[model samples]
Target chain A: MVGIVVVSHSERAAEGISEIAAEMAGDTRIEPVGGDGQGGIGTVPDAIEAAIDAAAGGDEGGDAGDLDPVVVLVDLGSAVMNADVAVELSDAEATIADAPVLEGAVNAAVAATDPSATVESVREQAEAARDVDKL
Target chain B: MTEDGAAAVAAVAAVAERIEAERDHLTELDSAIGDADHGGNMARGWAAAAEAARDLDDPDTGTVAKTVGKTLMSEVGGASGPLFGGSLVFAAAELDGGVDAETAVAFAETYLEKVEDRGDARVGDQTMVDALTPAVHTFKKSIETDDLPPIEALAKAVDAAERGVAFTVPIRARKGRASYLGWRSVGHQDPGATSTLFILEELLAVAADRLGVDAPETDATSPTIPDEDPDEGASEDD
Candidate 1:
């Protein structure tokens, strides 16, 4: 089961997006990590690290053997910076992608729940969704 | 802070802080293909938002979102200003005065639709839409399943958002500043997508922490940060 993490500057936004995704996918295993920049919400190394710890720590079962590569989605600039740092700090094999807050949240949640989905595949789907004609 | 209002205040404060922290990095990414003002613009907009939020004492989600929207529209420059600003406005309208998980999902959907309408672009355009569209759908679907707690539901959305961000790598640009670069945009990751992912990641972390769930551990390596490259990927319009 591949893990999915959503990083945002606002904890509520992260929680909101994550909650929506879980509601959509019935049995899919997914995790959400949020890093609050506290004083500010931007992409910073420390904030990113906090997000990673939150996501990695929030895995429901802690099934390390079946752990899927974590995929991170970010909202804005510093959010990206921090997310990058989080990935680095955790020493986790993960892929980061840029996406809009609302639409990407919907598409990513659906893709993450698919059993055969991999980080690469999910990335492709997200990119594909960018083309209005395709949608 | 009222029972429901506290979350909104907290959310706005968190977003403002995150933006301030990441302003430089955003500018760096924009400098690659834009006017090199993405960070500055975002910082100014978010600073204004933070100030307004702080002044509110205690406000509802809609009020906070409106403040964010107005600040971004008035203070920020470039394409992202209107795009992000409009998104917040739409979300505020949808959220009305609520800040629950369901309202959040609805606000996101409204935000996506507005972006799509404003940009006239869809998925695979290598825009932020790529990330947002998927995440919203996933959230809606998850809610339809069972009555999972809010935290569990957020976990599912985070998963979807991660997948959405990952899907941006091979896409060719058809809109925004990257469109002029055409195929050149294929190999490079979209900055919009990157930022969107950052927002989602932050949201996930906050949600999980609120839920008191143990974080998932990973064993992956960090990504390499390349030196600032020239604007070979800049859109023709830019």
Candidate 2:
């Protein structure tokens, strides 16, 4: 029931990762929220807040309890800053983790869909990706 | 913390602090070939995640992962946010309320597959995949060997990740923002790779701390935030 929101400079990239995660997860409830960094617009706190809200099922007027914890994924600098502020301002319970944009996105998406997923597990997966020699 | 949740919550807290400490260096690396906001982005994401985790009176691993993942996805913008966010989500799923060598291995494998499918990049693509793929494989191998405990397995994985990041120095980038630079992307360490290394280093530090092997040195330079009484923020907005 954990919801995942993938924020990126490009909407396509977020959508791409979300699609794959949905495919892998099957019936699990994984929600993908895409924020287009459109011409630098994505870095705005308001935009990021909207994205998180949408991802949390807030946009549809779902009850907060029905709303699972929201996980926000982002791409670049100000976007990170703005997203941070946005989460602080919003009423929804949320958390953020660092993920390398290129590799961690898919892992995060898949992780978001699991019923028993936790922040520690997701961070471990992200950290584990740092090892290249084992691959 | 629940029996299965303690390790993960501790892990998230440890890594968030480490990432905050390393934020500037990450941005500097990104500045060389890409948008130059990697550190800022990662820092912002972790700060949000940390804050979210802190807000919980008593949090389970699932709650912590979802909170962190959502913050990263919403707060950080760029390719990194979603990618890193996805990794956490996948790891959480694999844990399934349990933390063990088998679950850890499963988390790694799931992470690798997600990266490949989403990024449209492979092992040799000169992306973070270079670091991630090797770490996952090594973790799996270590689990099979049974020669090391989870901490040791993580340590080995961290070493492999660093090596993988180093390998990116010579390869021409064939994916992500760096790909446009072609040969120019060589020589300079990939920002994604460098951050990936930091993530592993933080994880290892946390594991060691939990296992009582060695405690992480406190950061003397960080400005301390005075804790606001929880009573002041207890009102539910809804």
Candidate 3:
């Protein structure tokens, strides 16, 4: 199973979205990081990096070893920029999904929760949401 | 600390002070064309950068530069964080040990290139590039043609940057949040360009201090006190 990291400019938005996605997350790790540290509306690269660490289970002295690849989903503008920079700095195997944050996270949660889901499969399902009809 | 390294820190500290003082003004400018956070973001970023520079443990100039970049990237939010922060990181990669006239010229040139590549902005985009491009070109030209002392060359660069900032007032933005305004973005100075000019002015001040010459005070901006010579066992601020 792949892990999911949700990045939004608003801290509450990221956490709320993570919570929604978690309903379908099963055993997969889903972490949320957002907002400038000062309670402002902006994303922080350091926060994103920390979320990636938690998703990959790297904070407990070492990798939990059972962790899967992590995927990041970002909202507009600097969220994407900061996330890209964070991923580069972390030197991790994480990839940012190009899908919409809410829709992608929901689809990704379901895909990643499956025991057979690989990082690629999770990303595919997440991205495929773009074509899903929503009446 | 080497002479050049100490001078570099002084330059960044000067920028931090200037940004802090002008923060509200910068925000006012941004409010007209973009999000009003540019001022706050730059102020916080420079504060972190100044702290990093002050606390450097006699490291090489390159390490100091890298630390500044990393700190800004981590501390600053919004588009300027990555663009300005990435520029410093790239410049640090280009810099070696002690700073010299040629190395400073190289830093400006490389910084300009990195910003262009990262932002995909041009000279007329009403972005930071509008100011930085001219300043860098002026710096490089002064170094190549007249082989002027570092202070004089940097003065020209600062002058060019100021002119660039002024030129942004009437141009419609083509990039960043300001671009969303289309023609409405005209008639206001770009916050990024103004800040870029401030940074160049501080750099020129550093050059003048290093050469022990009084920089020409063409504008009302106050001059910064030069750091004590490295032999003086660091300044009180250190």
Top model by lDDT, which number?
3
Q: What are the per-residue Cα lDDT tens digits for candidate 3 across A1-135?
A: 578999999999999999999998888889999998889898887789889877876764654465457889988887888887777766456888989998899999999977788889888888887788878
Weakest ten-residue segment in model 2 chain B by summed lDDT: B218-227
Q: Candidate 1 docking: what grade?
A: incorrect
Q: Write the per-residue lDDT of candidate 2 for residues B73-176, one digit (tens) a residue.
A: 66666667656775566555776656677777787788778666556678777888999987777777766765567776677677778778988888888887
Model 1 score (lDDT) = 0.62
Interface RMSD of each: 10.5, 8.1, 1.4
Report the TM-score of candidate 3, chain B only.
0.88
**A1-135 per-residue lDDT for model 2 (tens digits):** 555666665666766766766676554344443344444445445565666666666766757665555666667653555466567656676666676654555566566556688756654554454453534
DockQ of each: 0.02, 0.07, 0.45
Off by over 4 Å in 3: A60-68, A113-121, A131-133, B117-120, B141-152, B214-238
Determine the TM-score of chain B of model 1. 0.81
Select the stronger candidate by TM-score from 2 and 3: 3
lDDT of each: 0.62, 0.67, 0.83
Higher-lDDT candidate among 1 and 2? 2
Return whichever of 1 and 2 wins on TM-score: 2
RMSD of each: 22.0, 17.9, 9.5
Worst 10 residues of 1 chain B by lDDT: B218-227
